[model samples]
Target: MSGTFSALNAATTALWAQRRALDVAGQNIANVNTEGYSRQRADMQAIGGSAVPAFYSTSDGIGGGVSVEQVTRIRDAFLEGRGHTEHANYARLSTEAGALEQVETAFREPGDQGIQSLLADVWDGWEAVTNGPDTDATRAQVLQQMEALVGGLHFASASLKAQWNQTRENLTVLVDDVNAAAASIADLNQAIQRGNQTSLPVNSLVDQRDLLVMKLADQAGASVRHGKDGMVDVIVGGVTLVGGTSATKLAVAGSLDLAGTGTSPVRVVTAVGGHTVRPDGTAAGQLAAMNGIFPSYQSDLDALAKDFADAVNGVHTTGAYDKLGNPGIDVFESADGSPINASNIRVAFDDPALIAASGLPGAANTDSSKADEIAQLRSKAGGPDATYRRLVVQLGVEAAVANRGVQIQQVITTQIDASRESVAGVNLDEEMTNMLSYQHAYAAAGRLVSTIDEMLDVLINRTGRVGL
Candidate 1:
C-alpha cells in the first residue's frame, strides 16, 4: 500500500510539473510577436528521497518525480547594457545629421537661387553701370540688383532664426517627454520592487521598465544602474534622473530667442536643483545645433553683410562722385543707423541718379573708375564672396561627416540588436517543439497514475476477496 501510494504521489507531481512547463511554453508562443518580450523557461528538479532513516520508513532507492523550481526570463545583462549605449549614440548622430540638413536647406547653396548667385548678379550690375555711367537704365538695374542681394541676406538670416527657435522649442518638448517617461519608470519600479518582495511574477513589469529606460537613452543618453528588489536607477550625465520609486524632472533653461543665445546659451538642468545635464543623445544634438551650428553660420552671414557694406561704401565715398557731383555717402545702411548685419542691411537710397558711378571729382558721367573698383571687390581675397564661399564649404564638410557617422553607427546598432534578439526574442518553432515534449510527458504521467490505481485495486479488493 505504501509503495502504491508513493508511486501515485510521484505520478501526481509529474503531471503538475509537466502542466506548468506546458503553460510556460504556451506563454512563449502567445507573445512571439510582442516587442521587448523576453523568452521564459521553467526549471524542473526531481524530488529527492527522504534523507533521514526511521524505523517506520522503508528504504526506497527510487526518488520522487519532478517538480517545477522556478520560471526564469532569458536575458543577457551585458548585451542589454551595450544596447543602451549604442542606441544613445545612434540617436545623437541621427539628430545632428537631421539638423545639418536643415541648415543646408536654409543656405540653398550651389544653385541659381542662392546667395552666391545673387552676389554675382550684384557685381555684374556694378560692371554694367561702370560701362554706361550716363544710362539711367543701367543705374536702375544696379539698384535692383543691390536690393535683390539684400533680400537674399535677409531671407537667409530669417530662415536661420526660425530654425533656431524651432529647435529650442523641440528641446523643451523633449524634456517634457523625458520627465513623463521618468515618472512612469518610477511608478514601474515601485510595482516591480513590491512584486519582488512577495516573490510574485514580475517579468512583464520588468519589460515595461526596460522599454522606458531605452526611450530615455534615446532622448538623453541615459544609463542604468541596478538596485535592490529588482529596481533600477536611471542616470543622465552622472546625475540620477530616477532612483528607486522617485523620479527627477528635467528643465531647459537658456535663450528663448536666437539673438539672445550669445548671452544666455542653452542648457538642460534638473527641475528642482537646476543642476546642468550635459546629455549626449538627441537633446545634446539639438543643443549643439542651437548654440553652435546655426549660430556660427548666422554670425558668418552677418559678418559678410557688414564687410560687403564697408568695402563698397569705402570706395563709393572716396575719390568718387554721383551725377550731381556731391560726395558719395554710404550705399548701404540700417534703418536706424544700427550696426549692419544680414537681417538689417538695406540699400540707402532708391534714386538711380544718386548712384556714384565715377571716380573723378565732378565727372560722374565720364569716369567709371569707382564703379569698376566696387565691381572688382568681388574678387578680393577677404571680401564678402570669399567669406560666404568658405562658410558654405565648411557646412558641406560638416554635414557630410555627420551623415557618414549616422550610417556607420546604424550598422553597429543593428548588429547589437540582432545579437540581443537571439537571446531574448521568442522562437515559435522552438516553443512548438517544447510543447510536444511537455504533452508527451504529461500523457506518460497520466498513464502511470492509471497503472498505480490498478495496482492498488488488485492489492486491496482482489487480494482480500479471492476466496469469495
Candidate 2:
C-alpha cells in the first residue's frame, strides 16, 4: 500500500514538472518577437529517494520524481559586450562622415557658383582692364568681379561657422539624452537589485537596462560594467555616470561663439564630480569636427584670403594712381590693418576711378602693365586657388576614410549582434518543438497518475470483496 501511494505521489510530481516546462515554452513563444527578450528555459532535476523505515522499504529504492529546479534566461555576456563596442565604433564613424559630407557641400567645388570659379572671373576682369584700362567700363567690370569674389569668400566662411554652431546644438541635445538614459539605467538597476534580493526572476528588468546602456554608448561612447546583485555601472571617458542606483548627469561647457577667430574647445563634464568626459560615440565625432576639422578649414581659408589680399595690394599700391593722382591706396584693407581673412574681407575701393591700371602714375589712364601683373597672379604655383584645391582634396580624403570606417564597423557589429541573438533571442520554431515535447511528457505523467489511482482502487475495493 505504501509503495502504491509513493508511485501515485511521484507521478503527480512528474505531471507538475512537465506542466511547468510547457509553461516556460509557451512564454518563450509568446515573447519571440519582443525586443531584447532572452529566451528562458525550465531546469528540471530528479528527486532522490525519500527516507523510509526498514519495515516499510519495498524493492531496492523508489525515486521520488522530477521537480523543477529553476528557470534561467540564455545569454552570452561576451558577445553582448563586443556588440556594444562595435556599435560605438560604427556610430562614431557615421557621424564624422555625415558632418564632412555637409562641409563638402558647402564648398561647392568644381562648380560655377564656388569660390574657385569666382576667383577665375576676377582674374578675367583684370585681363579685361589690361585690354582697355582707361575705359570706365573695364574698371567697372573689375570692381564688380572683385566684389563677387569677396562675397563668395564671406559666404564660405559663414557656412562653416553655421555648421559649427549646429554641431554645438547637437552636442547639447546629446548630453541631455545621455543623462536621461543613465538615469533610466540607474532606476532599472535598483529594481533588479531588489528583485535579486527576493530571489525573483529579473530578466525583463535586466534586458531593459542593457538596452538603455547600449543607447548611452551610442550617444556618448559610454562603457559599462556589471556588479553583484544585478547592478550595472556606466562610465564615460573613465568617469562613472551611473553606479548602482545612483546616476550622474552630464553638462556641456564651452563658448559656442562662432564670431571669434580662435578655436573654443568644448567640454563635457559630469554634474556631480565635474570630471571631463572625452566621449567615444557620435558626440565624440561631432566634437572632433567642430573643434578640429572645421576650424582647420576656416583657418586655411583665412590664410588664403590674407595672402591673396597682400599679393594684389602689393602690386596695385606700387603701380598706378587713383583719379586724384595719389598712389593707389591698398586694394584690400580691413577697417583696421589687422590681417585680412574670409569673414572680414571686402572691396576696399568703392569707386571704379580708384583702380590702379598702370605702373606709372602719369600713365594710369593708358598703361596696362599693373593690370597685367595682377592678372598673371592666377597662374602662381602656391596661390589661393592651389591652396583651396588642396583643402578640397584633404576634405574628400577624410570623408572617404570615415565612410570606410563606418562600413567596416557596421559589418562587425552586425556579425556580433547575430551571435548574441543566437544565444539569447527566442526562436518560435524551437519553442514550438519544446512545447510539443513538454506536452507529451505531461500526458504520459497524467496517464501514470491515472493508472496508479486505478491500482489503488483495485486494492481498496476489489481485494476485500471475497463473496463477489
Candidate 3:
C-alpha cells in the first residue's frame, strides 16, 4: 500500500515539474522581441528516498519524484563585459567621424563657393588692378575680392567656434545622462538586493539594471563590477559612479566657449572632489573634437589671416601709393586695431581711391609694379595660398581617417553584439520545440497518475470483492 501511494506521489511531482518548465518556455516565447531580456531555464532535481533504514519499510532505491531546483537566466558574464567595451569604442569612433564630417562641410573644399575659389578670385582681382593701376573700377574690384576672402575666413572661424560651443553643451547633456543612469542603476541595485535577501525573483530587475549599465558604457565608458546580493558597481576612469545602492554624481567644468578654452580647458569631473574623468566613449570623442580638432583648425585659419595681412600690408604701405600719390596706409586692420585673425580680418578702408596700386610714390596713376607684385604672391612657395591649400589637405586626410575608423569599429561592435545575442537572446524555434517536449512529458505524467489511481482502486475495492 505504501509503495502504491509513493508511485502516485511521484507521478504528481512529475506533473508539477513539467508544468514549471512549460511555464518557463512560455515566458521565453512571450519575450522573444523584448530588448535586454535573457532566456530563462528551469532546472530539475530528482528527489531520493530516505537513507535511514526502518523496520517493515521496503527499500527499492528508486527516486521518489522530480522537483524544480531553481530558475536562472542563460547569460555569459565575459561576453557581456566584452559587449560593453566594444560598444564604447564604437560610440567614440562614430562621434569623431560625425564631427569631422561636419567640419568638412563647413570648409566646402574644392567647391566653387569655397575659400579656395575665393582666394583665386582675389589673385585675379590683383592682376586686373595691375593691368589698369589708375582705373578706380579695377581697384574697387580688388577691394571686393579682399572683402570676399576676409568674409570666407570669418565664416570658417565662426563655424569652428559654433561647433566647439555646441560640443561643450552636448558634453553637459551627456554628463546629465550619465548621472541619471547611475542613479537608476543604484535604485535597481537596492531593489535587487532586497529581493535576493527575501528569496524573491530579481531577474527582471537585473535586466533593467544591465540596460542602464550599457547606456553608461556608451555615454561615459563605464565598467561594471559585480558585488554580493545581486549588486553591481559602475566605474568610470577608476572612479565608482555607482557602488551598491549609492551613486556618485558627475559634472562638466571649465570652458563654455571656444574663445575661453585656451585659458580654461574643458573637463569631466566628479561632482564632489572635482577629480577629472577622461572617458573613452562618445564623451571622449566630443572632448577631442572640442579641445583639439576644432581649435587646431581655428588656429590654422588665424595664422593664415595674420600672414596674409602682414604680407599684403608690407607691400601696400611701404613702396606703393594711392591714386593721389600720398603714402599708403595699412590696407587691412581689425576694427579694434588688434592683430588681424580669421575672426576680425577686414579691409581697413572701403574707398577704391585709398588703395595703393602704384609701385612708386607720386607715380601712383602710372606704375603697376606694386599690383603685379601682390598678384604674384599667389605663386609664392610659402604664401597664404599655399597655407590655405595645406589646411584643406590636412582636413580632408583627417576626415577620411576618422570615417575609416568608424567603419572598422562598427564591424567589431556588430560581431560582439551578435555573439552576445546568441548566448542570451531568445529563439522562437527552440522555445516551440521545448514547449512540445514539456507538453508530452506533462501528458505522460498525467497518464501515470491515472494508471496509479486505477491500480489503487483495484487493490482497495476489487481485491476485497473477489470471490464474494
Candidate 4:
C-alpha cells in the first residue's frame, strides 16, 4: 500500500510539472512577435531520494518524479552590450550624414541660379561696360548686375543662418527626448527591482527598458551598465544620466552664432551636475552642423563678399573718374563700419552718373580702360571666383565622406543587430516546435497519472476481493 501511494504521488508531481512547462511554452508563443522579448525556458530537475532507510525502501527505488527548478529568460549580457555600442555609433553617423546633406542643399551648387553663376554675371556686366563705357544702357547694366550680386550674397547668408537656427531647434527637441527616455528607464529600473524582490518574472519590464535605452543612445550616445537586482545605469559623455531609480535630465543652453565663438552655440549639459556634454549622437550631429560646418561656410561666404567688394572698389576709387568729372568714390561700403561681410554689404553709389568708367576726367566717354581693368579681376588667382569654387569643392568632399561613413556604419550595425536577434529575439517556428514537444510530454505525464490511479484501484479493491 505504501509503495502504491508513493508511485501515485510521483505521478501527480510529474503531471503538475509538465503542466507548468506547457504554460511556459504557451506564454512564449503568445509573445513571440513582441519587440525586445527574450525567449524563456523552463528548467526541470529530477527529485532526489527520500529520507527513508535503504532496507525499508522498495527494490525499484527511482526516488521521485520531475520538479520545475526555475524558469529564466534567455539573454547574453555581453551580446546586448555590444549591440548597444554599435547602435550608438550607427545613429551618430546617420545623423551626421543627414545634416550634411541638408547643408549641401543650402548651397544650390552646379546650377544656373547659384551664387557662383551670379558672380560670373557680375564679371560679364563689367565686360559689357568695357565695350560701351559711356553708354547709359551699359552703365545701367553694370549697376543692375552689381545689385543682383549683393542680393545673392544676402540670400545665401540668410539661408545659412536659417539652417543654423533649424539645427539648434532640432537639438533642443532631441534633448527633450533624451530626458524623457532617461526618466522612463529610471522608472523601469525601479519596477524591475521590485519584481526581483518578489521573485516575479520581469523579462517584459527588462525588454521595455532596453528599448528605451536604445532610443536614448540614438539621441545622445549613452552608455549602459547593468547592475544587481536587474537595474541598469545610463551615462552620456562621462556624466551619469540614469542611476538606479534616479534620472538626470539634460538642458540646452546658449544661442546659435556664425562665428563659432562665444557661448552662443547651444550646448547639452546635465541639469544636476552641470557637466557640459559634448556632441555624441544626433545631438552631436546637429551641433556640428550649426556651429562647425555651417559656420565655416558662412565665414567663407563673408570673406568672399568682402574680398570681391574690396577688389572692385579699390580699382574704381583710384583709377577712374565719374561722368561728372569727379574721381570715383568707394563703389561699395559697409552698412556699418564693420568689415563688409555678406550680410551688410551694399552698393555705395546711388546715381548712375557717379559710376567711373573713364580713366581720366577729360578722357572720351568711350575710354574703356578702367572697365577693362575691372573685368580682368575675375580671372585673378585666389580671387572671389576661385575662392568660391574651392569652397564648393570642399563642401562636396565633406558630403561624400559623411555619406560613406553612414553606409559603412549601417552594414556593421546590421550585422550586430542580427547577432542580437539570434540570441534574444523570439522565433515563432522554434516556439511552435517547443510547444509540440511540451504537449507530448504533458500527454505522457497524464497517461502515467491515469496508470497510477488504475494500479491503486487494483491494490485497494481487486486484491482484497479476489480471495473472497
Taken over the whole model, the C-alpha lDDT of each candidate is: 0.91, 0.84, 0.89, 0.82
Q: Whose TM-score is greatest here?
A: 3
Model 4, range 1-468, lDDT digits (tens) per residue? 666777777777887887888788888888878877787888989876655557755445577778988888888778777776777788777877776676667666877767888888988998998888777788888888889888888888888888787778788888988888889999999999999999887878988998888787778777788898989999887788999999988888776555543447667887776679874777777776776777778888899999999889988988698877778888888998899999999999767777787897763466877778889888999888888999889888988998898898889889988888888777888878887887788788788778878988887879989888
lDDT of 3: 0.89
TM-score of each: 0.96, 0.92, 0.97, 0.93
Candidate 1 lands at a TM-score of 0.96
What TM-score should be assigned to candidate 4? 0.93
Q: Write the per-residue lDDT of candidate 1 for residues 1-468, one digit (tens) a residue.
A: 677788899999999999999999999988888888899999999998887868878559687878998899999999999998999899989988888898888878888879999999999999999889988898999999999999999999999999999999999999999999999999999999999899899999998888888898888998999989999999987889999999998999988888888998999998998999998789988999898888888998889899999999999999788988877889999866789999999999999988898877784357888999999999999898898889899999999999999999999999999999999999888999999999999999999999988888898879988887
Top candidate on lDDT is 1
Candidate 1: which stretches are off by over 4 Å?
Answer: 58-61, 465-468
Residue 389 Cα positional deviation in candidate 3, in Å, after optimal superposition: 1.1
Q: What is the C-alpha RMSD of each candidate to the true structure, in Å?
A: 1.7, 2.5, 1.4, 2.4
Sliding window of 10 residues with minimal summed lDDT for model 4: 256-265
What candidate 3 gets wrong by more than 4 Å, as runs, is 54-59
Alpha-carbon runs more than 4 Å astray in model 2: 51-61, 258-264, 322-326, 335-337, 466-468
Question: Of the candidates numbered 1 and 2, which has the greater lDDT value?
Answer: 1
lDDT of 3 by residue, 173-284 (tens): 9999999899999999999999999999999899999989888889888899999998999988779999999999999998888877788889899999999988989998
Residue-by-residue lDDT tens digits, candidate 2, 1-468: 777887888899999999999889888888888888889999999887845656745454668888998888888888877877788888888888888887787777768988889989999999998998878898899899998988888888899989989988999999998888888998999999999999998988988888888887788777778899989898887888899899888898766765442544777887766678888888888877777778878888888899889889988888567545567878887755667898898888778888887777664357778889899999889877687778888888988888898888888889988999999998888888888898899999999988988988888999989777
Candidate 1's displacement at residue 464, Å, is 3.5
